[model samples]
Target: MGELDSTLGAVLIAGLLAAVLHGLTILQTFLYTQTSGSDGPLMRCLVLFLWSVDTLHTALISHTLYFYLVTNFGHIGVLAAPTWSIIVAIYLTSLTGIIVRIFLAYRLFLLCGRYRPRLRVALPAIVMIPTMITFLTGLIFASKAFIVRLFARLDTFSVYLYITFSAAALADTLIAVSLCVLLYRSRTGIEQTDSLLTTLIVMTINTGLLTSIFALLCLITYSIWPLKFIYVGMYFSLNKLYVNSLLGSLNARKILQAKQERSTHDHRRSVRSTRFEVVSEPASYLSPAESITMSGVAQKESFASTSNTLHQNHVPDQT
Candidate 1:
């Protein structure tokens, strides 16, 4: 009983911290999209949907914990009976996970063009199907949790939950690896472009790794100590992690774009500086005709250079 109390307390604390971070990330997403104006209508809609789901998830979990700790304090039996709030929380979490997985899968698809058939996109898409199935099954089982009196009596449900978490972890791993591989292959020999891709690769790993690690932790704790609610702690925070990851990924485009613009600007400035240096050199050593010819050639070169720069600036960056 003492251990269970401590575990429940930990779950509540973790949930609170996760909610705070979720709110902060939501603000970040809003500010980033507004400033960048890069995300299209579809992308903006997706971001809004994710934020709403995350808010609902946080509210549901907060209600569940509050009901147990404050409204029904000293009644441990209430903790054994699954509430509608928690069940809905589970559904939202699974839904968020599926959405995020599909989003990344789409990114992988885009990154790997169809010009040449490859398993990069196909493999992750295949893995996601099972992941979605297990998550749905787990949600269904969770809704039936009221039939069991205690956490220890949920052996059948535990199996589904374990599979759900395992599948999620596997899907994340595959997405991260596939994205890294595609990005690595796409790196051009240009240093600026390569640096931008490297930053993207790192962001991909960080986001995917965090969610995968939490899912694995939830699975491990549930398997080893099914009687405890420690796994619930991890499960409650999963949605926030997914939402933050998605938002973070979307917001990153601004950074990449800014870096690319700066790189291009620097390159242009260097070319202009070199041209000026050549034009400013002494031409007194040559005859008047030669000097006149040199001046004419330099003027034509300057005009061409200015036109090229304007065209380059107007053209969109494919990256």
Candidate 2:
């Protein structure tokens, strides 16, 4: 009973939590569709793809739990082997994570590309290397688990699981740090623009750290209590976090835009008759939402020859 409690009980609870998070993921996706009509087709397709994958992920894990706790309820021996659904679900989790990471890496690349061509190319590659490692190791982890087919023998190749989580953590940390550093560096002396950058930096840290913390927790719990399913439980929630973070970032563009508008209005009022002009520059960091814009400027207090600037006009409120 103690063994069953630790293994099956933990998975059951984790699956419940995952179901709850999946509900939130669905809500966020619906909200995204309603609010992001102006977003490019590629962005729309990406959102749909992630939601579909996550839905399937939820279904598979649910089936796995059902198979153990209900279908084979009286057969204690069944707990020794993993269901095929659970292994495939783990692979899907990896797939969802890599897709989100690649999207974020591209955003980071856009942010850095204007400042230095080499940096733009190099930073995304650095992030992706670990990301790809995580994905491949995850594939290998699933394959080995399917081959071994027994819970008791997982330790024999636990190294693969460790590598998968470790590489994921590294990739997420690199992306967060790189983005925060670039946003910090983008600060113009203008209070509105600087505040906007600060907000973006904070968002990057929170989202990035959220996933990274769970990956580490999964790794830590598994290391300390290898026989328990606590790590698997954590793994269940981790995929949902990846999807929600992406959606949250996308949705935040509206809030940031509203804040930028109010700040711009106040700044304009303070100067009374002063006019702000948008100068032309290459390397636009305009996102699908177009919340903030950067351009070349000759201002004395600007961060660089190219300055962080927000316009009075932007995408209409999607609400």
Check candidate 1 and list the clashing pairs: none
Best by lDDT: 2
Instruction: Mark the regions of model 2 whose C-alpha exceeds 4 Å error after superposition.
Output: 273-308, 311-319
Q: Among all windows of ten consecutive residues in candidate 2, which has the lowest summed lDDT? A: 289-298
- lDDT per residue as tens, model 2, 164-224: 9999899989988998888887776677777877888888899898899999999999999
Judged by TM-score, which candidate is best? 2
Q: Which segments of candidate 1 are over 4 A away from where they belong? A: 146-149, 277-319
The TM-scores of all predictions, comma-separated, are 0.83, 0.84
Error of 1 at 170 (Å): 0.2
